[model samples]
Target: MLTIIYEDEQYVAINKPNGLLVHRTRIAEEKKEFALQLLRDQLGYRVYPVHRLDRGTSGVLLFAKNSAAATPMVQAFEERQVTKTYYAIVRGYTAESETIDNPIRPDKDHQHKEAQDAVTHYTRLATIELPIAVGRYSTARYSLVKIVPETGRMHQIRKHFAHIRHYIIGDKRHGDWRHNKMFLEELDSKALLLHAYEMQFTHPFTGELTHIAAELPENMRRLCLSFDWVNAVTKHEKLTDSPV
Candidate 1:
């Protein structure tokens, strides 16, 4: 069942699991289940998706109860008025803080489309060096990062991180195969490590500020526990500090 993290008269949010498509699309036509269908069935009502999350990314996803309610919410996202926070476990130890400003294609298949400007700010929260070896490195190094995107673009976080060569662990599309293989074979982790984490926006109808957070998914939490970064994860989950 989908976990409902926030709900009100006109809006609802779910902690979307990794690999769940936001809705039906031709690219994934063979997939029988989708978050939209499942959420609608669970609620027994129509819901409109205001934005989308990548099929491989898991975390806070918002929807409006009615079309009228969806309009403003959608506009908020388009206008970049909403704040989104994401957490990722990346392959190498990143800088204490960094910002990535680059252009990326809208999607992998749309090479003809013009690349859009994308900016991502991240702060390294914790680092770990596993004794296990992957590739030529004697020890595997990784970092937990808090990411905030200044613009919403397709695969922005994944692509931005890849642009800087700190590929997010478990990102099959743009990650290092050696690290991904290590994560799957050695750690038994298959889900993408990038998580939406939290979102804050103004209530479209009520004119109030709304902040919603989703707890880390089991796979991510387990990995954090193994890395001994659970305390850092817990501290950030509270949304205490402003987005970097």
Candidate 2:
């Protein structure tokens, strides 16, 4: 069963697990289970997705209990009124805090590829250096980062991080293969490390400010614990405060 993080008469949210699609798509037709289907079945009613999270991302995914509530919620996201926070484990130590202002293709398809303005702000919350070596390096270094995107283009965070060469760990498409192999083979960590940790927006039904936060998935939490980043994992204030 999906973990419901928030619920109301007009909206409901779930801590969507990694590898679950929000809805059906032609690109992944072979996949059967979806968050939309599972949640609708669980509630025995229809739900409308206000926004989408990547299939590999896990965290607070909100759905409107009815279509009336979905319109304003979707509009809020389109107008950049919603504040979304994410956490990621990346390949190297990121800057104390930085803004990535770059352009990215809207989607992976090459047919209509056009670069669009995308901006992402990130702060490094924690860092760790391990003696384990994957390639030529004698040690491995990583950082836990808090990410906030000013614009929501597809794969903006991943691509922007890749642009600066601090590849997000476990990102198969745009990450360091050596580190990915090391994590999979040595650490047995295979899921993408990016997670949608929290979302804040005005409630469409009640006109009240709403904040929803999801706990880290077990895999990412365990990895953070192993790296001695317990404070970073447990404290949201640290994620938003002065960078480490």
C-alpha lDDT score of every prediction, in listed order: 0.91, 0.89
Name every residue pair that clashes in candidate 1: none
RMSD of 1: 3.9
The residue pairs found clashing in candidate 2 are none
Model 1, 31-64: lDDT tens digits are: 9999999999999999999999999999999999
- Residue lDDT tens for model 2, 1-244: 9999899998999999988999999899999999999999999999999999989889989999888989999999999999999999998888999999998876556648778889999999999998998699999999999999999988889899999999998888888899999889988899989999999998876889999998888788878877878777658533323322
Reference-based TM-score of each model: 0.95, 0.94
User: Quick one: RMSD of model 2?
Assistant: 3.8
Model 1 accuracy (lDDT, Cα): 0.91
